[model samples]
Target: MQNLTTKLLAAAALVAVAGCAKKAPEQLPPPPPTETTPAPETSQPTGPVGSTVVPGSKEDFLQQVGSDRVLFATDQYDLSGEARATLDSQAAWLAKYPNVRITIEGHADERGTREYNLALGDRRANSAKNYLATKIDAGRISTVSYGKERPEVAGSDEGAWAQNRRAVTVVITGM
Candidate 1:
């Protein structure tokens, strides 16, 4: 009888543990929203605009400005092929206007040390600026590292990290 009770208790414990085990569902992010509204007008384009869209022109540039188009790799300043492809469009716009100068703003997420992130952001911005300048004159390009000072997504996940690693082109003026 004692042996039978011990076996029953062991079986119950096993069942309890098995019942407690559960597999969490995978995390699925939502799709980006569509932009249907027309952008606000600012001024005429001064320099070259992107092939798909103009850059020097205020309205055309608005397609990307203050937008989360730019993307980067995790803990990396090197421009990935995907990133270069995206920048390719920006370069096209920069080429359209010779007088237009741009500042490549490098930004990072808040996952690392602040100083490290700042330096990383600077490197990222410079990397983008370097790539673009290679196609044009270095004088037309400038870079700044915002570090993790500002986060576009503002979260502690791969989703936010991806958004943070970016080099944005800020159009200063048209030529």
Candidate 2:
């Protein structure tokens, strides 16, 4: 009789545990919405395609000033007439955006010692900075020399070297 009672109790406990267990439905509900989820039809872009350039942004600067860099002759920091024209456009853009601050990055081709290249880069950056100072506030400009450490193009040929030796005006702070 005691064994019979034990078996009955065990069966009752198993039934209770099985009733407590959750059973999944044949189909699951959809997942929660996420940040990357597409917006509703009302939230779609209305402007012309590629007309979404934000004001005072880097893209706007590039669009307004054609190019941000000026190429230099090998081992020279002086601005050619073409370089000056490019700087003039850059200055015009800066003038339009009064809250902008810029850094002129001087770069050199891989031809000289590291120390010499760095110095040349500094001179190149300064030359561009000084020119921009005449149009924009001198306080808003800064210079950095990467020398041959950061090249736009990497090669031993003149074509690559010509592209690498340049001063690039970058927007450091903006609206």
Candidate 3:
């Protein structure tokens, strides 16, 4: 009689548990789509007369100035006529944006020793910086020589060396 009572109690507990179990939630309908306006074009040139779009912007400077770098003659830190012209344009652009600060990176070909190349690169960077100082504030510019450590082109050929020996103007901030 005790076993029969125990079985009945166990069956009642199971029935209660089954009855208390949660049911699955009903599915919700998908949200309706909404219309969106087309985004404005950013690549178009829309600046002052004879100037590129967004004068103080980096993209405008790159497009108007042709390149941010100037190549140097072998073993020389002097600015060539072409380099001077490029820097002239750069100076104009920098003048237009007084808030811009820059770093001049000096580089050299792979022919020289690491220490020698580093020194050469420093001279190259300083040369460019000095020229730019006449145009922009000296305080806004800094210099660093990568030497032969970072070459624009690899290998020891004249072609690669020509590309490697260069000073590059990089916009640091406020542009």
Give every collision pair in model 1: 45-56, 45-57, 47-97, 48-96, 48-97, 49-55, 49-93, 50-93, 99-175
For TM-score, candidate 1 versus 2, the one ahead is: 2
* Candidate number of the best TM-score: 2
Per-residue lDDT value at 125 in model 3: 95
List of clashing residue pairs for candidate 3: none
Model 1 C-alpha lDDT per residue in residues 1-175, reported as the tens digit of each score:
9999999999999999999998886976886643323223244643455454544454565564334146777888887887777777777655666666677889998888999999999988888877887788889788888899988888899998888788888776433
Arrange candidates, best TM-score first.
2, 3, 1
* Candidate 1 runs further than 4 Å off: 1-55, 64-69
Candidate 1 at residue 37, lDDT? Answer: 32
Per-candidate TM-scores read: 0.63, 0.70, 0.68
Q: Is candidate 1 or candidate 3 better by lDDT?
A: 3
Cα lDDT tens digits for candidate 3, 69-135: 9999999999999998889989987776677677899999998699999999999999999999998
Ranking by lDDT: 2, 3, 1
TM-score, prediction 2: 0.70
TM-score of 1: 0.63
Q: What's each prediction's clash count?
A: 9, 0, 0
How many collisions between residues are there in candidate 1? 9
Give the worst 10-residue stretch by lDDT in candidate 3. Answer: 33-42
- Evaluated against the true structure, the overall lDDT of model 1 is 0.74
